[model samples]
Target: MIQTLKLHSLKWLCIALYLPFSLAAATLVGTPRGWRNIDWLDVFGEGGGALMVLAWTLLILGSRPAGTVSNLIFAGLGLIFVSLWQDNIDEFWIIPDAQLWDTWLENVPMPIGVVILTLGLIRWYQEQRILMAQLSKRERFRREHRSVDPVTRLASADYLEQQLDVELRAARRDQAPVSLLLLDVDGFDRINRRHGVAEGDRLLQALTDLLLLNLRDGDLMCRYGGDRFAIMLPHTNETMAVIMAGELTAAVSHFAYHTHYEGERVRLTASVGLALALSDSPRALMQRADHALADAKQKGAGSHASAA
Candidate 1:
């Protein structure tokens, strides 16, 4: 568990030692106030707050992966705990007027900790928004697990067809345009041959995450087949779909996929095809997209084509 926490135990130990050292320093420089003169209420309140903050820090370190946000939060909480601990110590000890370091220790860290904590919280909120978007994508297909692809955790080809039919009917009723994007991983077979099938599966999963991040709300993505993905864009015209397809292709080309074994970074590229929903049937629209995809592949890697 300590190893899994990625050296958080060392951080915790350091903080724990700091508290005692701070108390020892205060005792060394200051005289203990009489029992009647000590403010027991202030000590209890500040001490309790410090303990609570310490608990929260431990909870965060245990639950979250070690990253920038987690580190900021942990450091911020540790500083706050130190400030509170110093305050509690001050309640029971009387420092000389000449000693200014104790005052700095109690006052300086609180505001700095607050500022760091606020920044961490803002970053955490943004992270949660991205995670929520990803979760919503998976939640849509949760009810029909049989129609979800295991590798990418995306909807299957059958589910994509079903959603296409539904979206097409709604588009016709509203007189709005709908578009389809077909994306194919370029040289995926070569990747599989060079880096095992497990690595290939991981690459597909990473690609799925990238696609989800680029998509807007209400867009549906599905694993069409082995290395092909289909996206249904409601209310999107051919021009917008084509632009999105080009962006996705560029994003894939820039992505660096790493191998699990040798940790070697591999660059990947994709070909994308865009088709407007002119036909009433989902099968016809998919066929047009598929034909366009073949044309895109012929043009070479990272190419995009739009069907008329």
Candidate 2:
């Protein structure tokens, strides 16, 4: 309480000094002469500056998305607001009459703020474009984090089924084609045995990155199970899925994986299965894909195979 009283006493002393200076200033000869009778102009102008400072601080601190363009826009507007407040405050105080420095103090920060805000915004746009490309598959998981897979950081099997269901209904209505591509590591059990489970986990992470790189923005990829991924292709036909499956096979077959502990290159392959909805429910569609993947596994042991 004593510290608070001391601070309050200091504040009162500052007010006492400033208040006398404020009262001594002669009123300006303006057409709206009645306006100078009250100190409302000074109060409002100072309030405005205080509010602008608050806004600018919030924008600068809160806009931390690494060059936030949206934040730049907000900050530029705040600068303009503060410049106007400074200009307004000058009307009440006529310190050393006819001084140009007061106007400069009011106006210079505006343009500088604009320049800084513009650069920040441009960088933000570039970063956003790059991010959109990198996490393109995550578009399907937008505004909803609950359905995302904790392990792979992609959408889960449940999300896949939900999306497939929605896309299937739309396809049936518009006569557009929608298909699913399932990919699983070939003999993942053996890899786990040879490299240990931790290494196997690293392989899965590598596999996830490779798959994400190969997929388009509209396509959805999910972790269906251990060392398995499912891709939902909207407005895609069986032939397109086949071609993509082939590409996935090629990408994984040639993927050069290095173990962190051993620094040894571990090669891995994936078996893929393609399934078209074909007027089936989401459950039935998944069953068909599962069976197709099983068929691909039985026929081939080391390479990517397709099911009938």
Candidate 3:
């Protein structure tokens, strides 16, 4: 968590420096308003707003990775917080009429902040759309965290079967084709024996990321079991599924995974099986994919087979 926060140090450092300077400016050039002249209502309201804005800025920086959307949102929130802080301070400090800095501080940032915030939100909407597309597969399983595998963060076998049933029904109703691909890491047990289980787990996680990057937006990838993954491709036919399976096989073969401990390059390969939905049951589809996967494994590493 500390390391993650450090990734957003730019925003935090800015806030830290800005706060002291704003306070020092308020103290140096302005006289403290007497208790009788101070507006308590403005102090409470503007002070609360500034606090809330600061909270929001911290929340955004903490939750999101450092990227374009995060940077924009952080900047906008920072500016808004600064403006509100100045406004709140103005209630307690009486600046000379000749001094325009206080007015500039209170007025300049708010509208600029709002414009930047609007642009950030628009980009955020687009980003969410892509993520939702990627997540649509897992969403079919009711979003149970327990159903997610700890290693790959993909749906577990039981959850995959449940979602397969849902997709099977949808396919039957719409008369659309659905395909399943089963991929198993070749020589994974050898990797574990040679490099340790921790390294093996790292390999699985890295392979999961690679597969996800290669899959289509709507495809659902799941951890069927150890060293085995299943993918559900809705509205895809046998030929397209076979092609995708081959692509996955090639991708895994090309991936150069390195051991975390030794930094030794671990070359990898995978066998893939593709089966189109013929029956309206998840069991039938999975069984065929499994059979095809077994055939691919028998053929050799980096091989793929489609169910007849």
The model with the greatest TM-score is 3
- Cα lDDT tens digits, model 1, 37-57, are 987789789999999998898
Off by over 4 Å in 1: 1-133, 138-142
lDDT of 3 by residue, 161-272 (tens): 8878888888888888889999999999999999999889999999988988888767788999999999999889877888899899999989988888789999899999
What are the per-model C-alpha RMSD values against the true structure? 8.7, 9.8, 4.6
- The candidate 3 region of ten consecutive residues with least summed lDDT is 133-142
lDDT of each: 0.86, 0.71, 0.87
Worst ten in a row by lDDT for model 1:
134-143
lDDT ranking from best candidate downward: 3, 1, 2
Candidate 3: the clashing residue pairs are none
Candidates sorted by TM-score, best first: 3, 2, 1
Q: Is candidate 1 or candidate 2 better by TM-score?
A: 2
